[model samples]
Target: MRLSNLIPSIPANVVACLEVQGIRTDTDLLFSTTTFDIYKRLPAGTATLEELTEYTTIAAEIGAAPGMSGHELLLLENTYGDVQLRTGNAELDGLLRGLDGRWIIELSGDKGSGKSTVALNLLINHLASNLEDTALWIDTTCDFSPERATQFLDATQTLPSTLERLQVSLAFDIDTIQGILETLSRPNDPRARPRFLVIDTITPLLGPLLSAVSAQGHAIMTDFMRQLQTFAQASGTAVFVINNSSRKGRDTPERKPALGPSFALLTDTTLWLEAKNDNNTEDSTEDNTVHTMQILKSRSAPIGGCCTFRIHGNVICPT
Candidate 1:
């Protein structure tokens, strides 16, 4: 019964999740058929039968041992009120807290700016912080693949509970898109019960919702946003709406970002993603690619301040 036997057959991820619940050591695990199935699949014997028995017995004992601890719960006191903003970036984490009630974190930039990577990184971190809260991610396009998510988890060192908290609605229809969010916002829905929502690339959903012209588009936009805002406020949930920038034409550097003015008004914060070329093609010192991000509109903090980040596989790192 060597510890090494538990290596492959059992997904490190399963054990990892339990570890976050303060069940770090193997002795803390609650033994059950699920545990046996997982470990049995590993090499013949990782830990001796005696060791496994002891671990399970302790797990059951700990389970019966409790009143709740206050820290594990999320801050839902603001449920259905104003949206609050917090930066996942440790650097700005302190600077940004409770900035606004309705926030929009827009990730934009040329290709490979690590825009999606950053979004996933923040989410993983958020999940690790609130393991009990259930969260939903609506991917209008198939962009939000689980494989990609796993990569990000490893990179950010996100806990298993955080990863499990997420329930993704993949490749949804144009019409059925917002319904995913609306339904989750419903009081009884388990996923939305935690008040966390993420609509990756909301444009696809907007396609069906937008009306004929300028005025109509504006009306639909506002009403739609209002629903999101109201639901977010009432529920104490943190929503991350990720979007891409358009290729309207790069006339001016200042006008690089492409977002409708009306749409911008509804958000409490916006982050613009951009790429900083470091390849030898232009200035060949290091054959590396660097993506830069900027706080386009904080509505509460410094503007134009840029931060460089990297998405190596699923991990987003400070470049």
Candidate 2:
């Protein structure tokens, strides 16, 4: 809806000022720009915080104004109503209760730990489902394989139409990555809005600078993560960020994510994946390699619980 229509009571001059700032619609005002930013764009002495808050409240109400009652929301929660997509692995699905669009899920693991494989599976499942949702994948590792995705599609017998719904982009640096995310955060077309966003190995883009304790790097990282979180909350898009793990010590058993504790704390849910056996030899074979996914943190469910799954020909399956 147009901004003018949503806030008809606002002065025409103020609305025109907002329009001049490229915020002509409610979606643009709410998702594309911040209130303080918008206020700065308006004419002097014409904008007020109270007015901006009112406009935001109205926009939010309009977005969720489907007349859903408290009891109905409760009923939906009982039926896993918030689940937007499934991983197809029963045990993993049970642990995650399916992917919720409202939360950010972080998948961190050691090298060759099937983080990309699991993310690709989720994208495939999201598009293959009956919902009208679409997905956006940002590949930073340059390892996203369409051929492997095709393997998944062929396995599930999904038509070519499903593949068409998945949009993919590659970003090699922090600036490019942030640009892609910011663009997705305020999509111009409603149909083009993504329901799922996947960033493969986010740590690689920011890890080096962060490790060196670069203040500028930290500032950029902070802005990027904050924008990402805001986008997830405002758009209700399920986000999956792949992070690489760092071995703590040669003798120590613990491994930490490359993004470190600060980044981990920002996510709503964190899943850490590791190979089950450290003693497994090179001839262990693909089928013999079992990975365990443990919930390091979760806001809506019990933590410390884990599930085991294996990767077989691009498919993540419960063992």
Candidate 3:
């Protein structure tokens, strides 16, 4: 049903603004992010907060009517539902429980810990399994190596076009990421919805905002996380964020995610990586280096599970 159908109930100007945002049908309004977010994007006088909330509520009810799955309602054919992503290494998959479901996961560690390698492995393996599926990589720190990704795809022996299905974007700030999330939230978007989403090294984007004197930083961080969660839940996109580790205190050995506890609490799981051998050694090759992945927290698996793996060429081998 078109937004114009509800014109008498909803303000005409409000519908016009929503249409400007590409919300033409009831499903579009229903799947778009929260009412407050939409309100903020609209012209100042277009819609009040209460008005948007009410309008969205109406859209939701209509969209949720009996016998209508979200995919059916939105006319989004062939959309992927909850899925278990694998890295093709049996031991690692067993350790991660196949990295199942649509949830937010964090992969964090010091440099050379093999976080990006493992993440890229996941993306390659998932895309290779089904050429029709797509994934997203948000390169916040400009660390996404296209050459490395190509090498991984070549190792899998999949067609060259498999790499084409992985959508990559360089977004170094909160606003850019927010815009990306909003675009993914739109039901009418032209690009295929990604089954997996990665934000590599979130530290650079969020690290500077966290300060001793400002609560606003925390609020902004929280909002960004919430928006990510909203997108994950709404779209069934398995989200992975690459994070960096930091010392818990001034002089202690205890380590925590650099984004702190607030960010940790928002994610469904967290995995910490550590390089057992220095891959930087002139004598060491990728085959000889070992990395350990430790699950610090999880909702689907045990909290202390650990797996050891090595990067040989572009493939992850369980050691």
Best prediction by lDDT:
3
Inter-residue clash pairs, candidate 3: none
Q: Write the per-residue lDDT of candidate 2 for residues 83-171, one digit (tens) a residue.
A: 35577878888887734656888899898777888888887887777457678899887888889898877877778788788888999
Model 3: residues with Cα > 4 Å off, grouped in runs: 1-79, 188-191, 278-283, 286-288
Provide the lDDT at 229 for model 3: 86
Displacement of residue 104 (Cα, Å) in model 3 is: 0.4
Candidate number that wins on lDDT, 1 or 2? 2
Superposition TM-score, candidate 1 onto the true structure: 0.62
Residues 244-311, candidate 3, lDDT per residue (tens digit)?
Answer: 98998998987777888888888999999998756678755855577888999988788999988778
State each model's CA lDDT, in order. 0.55, 0.74, 0.79
Q: Give candidate 2's error at residue 145 in angstroms.
A: 0.6
Q: Which runs of model 1 end up more than 4 angstroms from their true locations? A: 1-89, 92-102, 171-175, 188-192, 207-214, 247-255, 279-289
TM-score (C-alpha) between model 2 and the true structure: 0.70
